[model samples]
Target: MVAQEQKSSHVFDLLVVGGGVNGAGIARDASGRGASVLLVEQDDLANYTSSSSTKLIHGGLRYLEYYEFRLVREALIERDRLLAIAPHIMWPLRFVLPHSKLVRPAWMLRAGLFLYDHLAPHMKLPKSRGIDLRNHSAGKPLKSEYSKAFVYSDGWVEDSRLVVLNAMDAAARGADIRVRTRLAAAKRVDGVWEAQIEDKRSGETSTVRARAVVNAAGPWVARLLSDELAVPHSKSVRLVKGSHIVVPRVFEGPQCYIFQNPDKRIVFAIPYERKFTLIGTTDEAWGEAPGRVEISPEEVSYLCESVNRYFEKPVSPSDVVWSYAGLRPLYDDAAANASAVTRDYVLDLDTTGGAPLLSIFGGKITTYRKLAEHAIEKLIPEMPVLAGQSWTADAALPGGDLGVGGFEAALKRLRDAAPFLSLTHAWRLTRAYGSRAYDVVGAAGTLEDMGENFGADLTAREVDYLIDNEWAVTAEDVLWRRSKLGLHMTQEQRTKVERYIADRQH
Candidate 1:
């Protein structure tokens, strides 16, 4: 099971341990700056915390309550920047915060919305405004008592696709990406990082040398620093478990609802993937092992009750179509309340040891790009040859350059070229692949050319494309990470997919 080694002697300027959003983002930015980079992940890209997020590229309006104005402002700027670059996957989202006078006064809510509007004025996103809950379509699903609300602008991102597009861009820029490869250990040797990497799939291992190593392991950051690198852990990461649930689409309109709870932690009910509504997330201090973190019975009930209290249509366990849990690696601040802990990221670089191991802790998905830029800035004095000002600010992610704008037009073109594709199938492909939909459907005039049907809309050709290009190594990777087909596909279909992948290997 050894990884097909790319010549042992080929040295790298930077070695990144993790293929989550931050790691892939760092690799993309660093490699784009002309660094010889290598990014390794022990599992499929975005298969962990990155994919488990609430799936928004928001500025975190709630952070303002903790006097995190700076964090909120910076994230607001990033939200606008990401929308411009990855318009296909990232776009503007309007959040309606229905005011329940019992939870928080309307004046306090007004002040918050005022700051949210002016926080990042340089951005293209819309400003916040008061909404008459009874008149607005966004309030139709809400209970009658919630008669007033504030609507503010933020951004929504295809969380997992963001990681994939970043990794794809990094690879296209010449960075080496290794999936299912664990960073076993590392030591400074002759002023360079001599790291041992093991392939988790086949139990094969190899050693590599790099001038610098970045540990952006998210929830596993502390373990990577203390256990893998054998380095003294100076920074601590508090694992906060957040959970989300998907239910059959409940409300109409593109606007998402934000319920301000008495505990000060907000719950979001967002329009998701056309046919589903995404709601979440409960923030609780986690003392359990990181790997064992899952949505608890209490959390599920809390979320359902919170939503039911505000909405006309009550949400119960029976309405939940899917549920997911992710642990946020917050930089420990000794805050008594889990909700009060800062979500800001911190980078600790140990160049004093001759070789540098930069450990990243406590960042939100909204600010990963800026985090990557700041990270590379810290390494400039050490790796002087790594050139760059910042280029990612305006760059488009893979399949993101939808040149004109609407992906619907692109879908129309795809339909013209491949008339056999069903309307739903064409829409899915266009949204997923963007302009590259043509390459996927290339010369296939009929449904038969799509190769074997594995159930749902998944076809053999798409699976092969994921394996060859996206580093999809298993059926779960295809179903869960690469696509949400697992939600719709039956258990029998899932088994068939597993067999297809295994039989292909044989």
Candidate 2:
């Protein structure tokens, strides 16, 4: 039976299904445009593919080989735009691509770099240049055979935090964000969509009315369309599993490595969590449920072998401390190889017989903002009440208001305000929350005032903030998504956190 109290009588202009980057971004954009929006997620925000990305705001450099110039240029532009808007969570990083004669010739590498640089002329990042690995700092951990490299610029993002920030911004703009809520079914009712939503935790059902629906369900996009919405989509999504491994720091450098495999696939080795190196991801075809995806033993061995091929210190499966896998719901373009499939997104607007249903396919993290803008544009005819302009491009996500002085300035201000906080604690908070770090820290004047320490600088006060503001309900939500403190905490510490959150909920 439907819970009468949970039912929403008010009709939202748009109902965004999915709470990943794309969905959150769409809700933020649409709500900012004065459209009443309701966003529902089956799980915590960025609980899957969004958080499991390579975590780079980069143009798919390899896509240029496939002649995806438009996607590359758009991603390149978005990279800078993301950096400018969220300097605290997104910032510039230099990438070192060691030239392999066995993979590609120097001329081809140079040419690719040239195109990457010139693709977005207005980009503020430094241009790519050749470097002799023999004398460079980035070559210290590499084998002596790798004597030359090409360095270029890209941006790094706190992938999960980016999603949460967008949701927060949308909620602040009066959008209703419902997490742990599943979209059970939907049917067209007199030219409008009446969606049945279920609270996963309570087993309670409700109904919501909307003028339009956005299917940004990522891996579940195809299934949701066919099963729930009853919409026949001719276009299909190819689910490819990408896996990553986290190991002890491979090298002592700030630069990341883009290694080329003999199979023509590339793997990235990036510094992560300040103490570990992240290397991955293998592109293998997946046919299982997206949520059940996990890195296989073969994938671990492949990744270890991929890194061992270059580094002087061999990496084995034993060296891996953590590993994760996510399925990419790429648009099936009939490519012979999974890696050859286009990384660009495709939007299909269905306005045939009833209300509009926009299904998003094959989008990358680097271009989610643009994807949202385009999604809203497609719905403008259905929602003429929406503002005539796109405003998200110039707006900042929540906690990302760094002001004109940038990240360092924001960090300094946070440190000065909270003299009780240690340098490491203050820096982490500033990086994670930007100007809003003060909100989490609050009026605490001493360490004890921050409440229980669950290890690795994760205070109870921060946990409360996440629960009250960010919709974090469990220890996993706090440790993994709200922040990656799970990487730094022991099993005992994690259990304590779980117990604490459970007690609080009770």
Candidate 3:
């Protein structure tokens, strides 16, 4: 971790629990405002829902039916802002919504598209338009029945990296970011929170004093409030399990597809990792206690079938290369169906005990910045020490500055500097690290200079960089979360990565 300016007593101005997008974002914004913040995470950053998203910074095109104009507008506005600041990890994606007469009529699709385009005038993406799928390249994979589609714009994101970049920026601004650490307990005392934080690696408990606390724990928000913090009112989260499957490139194209199911749900099939096509996201009602979520057999079948209704080539369970599941801790609106639940967030602030406690309920990735801004703004009155007026809107995240020439220009420059790197290898490094790719490949004159090959372009040098800089301690953190190289590597190669990380730490 980078060293920061520390208070002599170590009494922080803010103690943030959870290191997901919301918590990390809050830490970045709060710390930028000069708050001495300490953020604690039970596991790795974005280890759960934050990383396991459909990986889009979209305006919830489907939520228009549910009349969530406020969320969609906020998301649409924030989406452009994020794209402007982080072009390396974020870019524009055009979605093709094929006309399914049996599902929704063309008029409804057109109406929704019209509303979506006009809702946020600041949207830099082109407005929606009707397309002739019969002749377009995107239509080549679709069945003959789908002759038309509504093409609209949204942005794709590296979800896990987004969380990490936020945490990195926060740490750079003097916030202490502790991963693999759990918030054991806390109590209100003398207008401050006396919190017990335990480092999971060492199991050593330490007391942290903070004038204010923000509960941004995603799935465990309610449990932490009632159990650990012991000061709660009546806000809860409804766990909705969403799962996705990765398959070999289904078709060739940059444009993604949005399929409408018979059950009134929408499924997306996006181009992923240059070599594979990504399909997702079923909203299954979860009743069990929150834990590691996995895609059930039924869900895989459902996803395959959802796309089968439109695609020419059929996909089956055997074709799936990988699958993942995550729990969406939506605000408990008592909606009968999981899909009907609101994606909007609720921030509950309880100041009854003199010490302020703010709890965030439901949120999506697209608007995490705004959520953080609002969260910090609400606590500002109580935390007079925190200064600044919403500075994150104009700031660039760590490694986001790609200069005037932007991504393509930077890629060209990296390839020029590291002449030995293959086109694919250079692209991977640039996408993952942006301007910092040079640092990862520092002074490496050849492939051999990159150190030991852990298969699929993952070199020992890169692993060491992730460890020393990105807080990567395990192979899974490198292969799966840091980058999705695990999908392309063999079991033996993955084991090598595991052994290497173990040996390095030892």
Candidate 4:
């Protein structure tokens, strides 16, 4: 039998590739400004790099030494902006950088902190200051050698959820979001992009047309340009593998610690999931294929040793419960090593053949919003003018209606209204869904009404909601990305969820 070809019914003004934070934010910004948008992803939203982040909305404090003052300043500004818009998924986090004269002298640390404090004058987080570890609460978890430290403020984010919320907002503002949909190929045809997109689930190929394409393909940015679109480009990304390990809680504190290594690199031990400490990230370079990314045994050992130097209790590879690694597609700035490579993004817009193709290179989670806004501005000339073109700078994402510092109030409201919910269950709902927790709760007056509870209070209702709304297609999507309940679920329970999603989809 001959194959049948399917075409998307409507042509979009902008076709965004990748469903990570940058692509989602671009879709949200463009669609909100009256541009018809279509965002396609090969897997679930944030299936890779976006979700495997340090999960901090920080200004890259260490970037100061590399003379990345401008990048740091821009990130700091966006960090504040993101906090106000999505306070539910983000919160204020203070970092304690233990001072070591051997690694970095006190004067050098103070000068760097001073620059960090004033780089963005409008920064809402508290200014950096020196502290006596002997008297500070953060000092209790440290070894005796660390006598002084510096405290500065940044924000923490539920990384993957932030990506989903952006995609949700874009969908709400009239963008078509297709997950588990891969863009196979595309070329300029008749002054637009005629592309082949495949449904990864059903193996069905379809065609979509768009006036412009945004290559937010993260690690695949360069390959997409040369192979898929067949567009010639001079810019490329340096894929650096960053790995993180989660161990049983290492310390008893809300604040986090940033440790200095003998090699002059820094490692962070962050309080995670209430019962574990999140430690990461090696600067090892990744030169292999894009899709397969994993933390090597060496990287794991490096991270453990990096943190053990300061913590009163030591951590080893055997103590790690879960570990993850992601590739950082840094714009290849011809830096000597991966550690010195710039973390700032560069938008390469080409209008060579007919339509516009915008390739995003090198960016962190803290700067995605600004990157999106900048992307749309660059493409505005290529696409039609949007009426009343207001940017997403001040817009609140879906369920972000709770004002700044209102997360606790929102949690209280959820508990009061849903008296049947355990505080832990209610807290998860509020943080993930925010003002929409009531929607997830639905009209259920009892826990049983929400249906079967497994893996520490994950209910049938919540899973259904994720399937129907958030484009969650698989069990891993629910257990790992949507929430970190996988860590709590037994292998048997996880299998049940996998079967449940499959059955529900059918």
Return the top candidate by TM-score.
Answer: 2
**Candidate 3: segments with Cα more than 4 A from true spot:** 1-8
Clashes of each: 0, 0, 0, 0
Prediction 4 TM-score vs. true: 0.98
**TM-score list, all predictions:** 0.97, 0.98, 0.97, 0.98
Off by over 4 Å in 1: 1-7
Q: For residue 357, what is the lDDT in candidate 1?
A: 79
lDDT by candidate, in order shown: 0.87, 0.92, 0.92, 0.90
Tens digits of per-residue lDDT, candidate 3, 1-506, equal: 33222123567988999999999999999999999999999999999999999999999999999999999999999999999888889999999999999989999999999999999876689999998988888899999999999999999999999999899999999999999989989998888888888877876777889888999999999999989998757889999999999999998879999999999999999999988999999999988888799999999999999999999999999999999999999999999899999999999999877888999999999999999999988998888877587899879887788777999898999999998999999988988888989999988999999999989999999999988877788999899988999988999999999999999888
Residue range 23-70, candidate 1, lDDT tens digits: 999999999999999999988899788998988888888888899998
Error of 2 at 43 (Å): 0.8
Write one digit per residue (lDDT tens) for candidate 2, span 1-506.
44543677789999999999999999999988899999999999998889889999998899999999999999999999999888899988999999888999999999999999999868899999999999999999999999999999999999999999999999999999999999999988988899999998888988999999999999999999999999988998999999999999989978999999999999999999999999989999887777858899999999998988899999989989988888888988999888998888999999966799999999999999999999999888877967568998879887778876888888888888888888889899999998899999999989899999999999999999999999998999999888999999999999999999999999
Off by over 4 Å in 2: 1-6
Between the candidate structures 2 and 4, which one is better when assessed by lDDT? Answer: 2
Please give me the total number of clashing residue pairs in predicted model 1. 0
Worst ten in a row by lDDT for model 4? 382-391
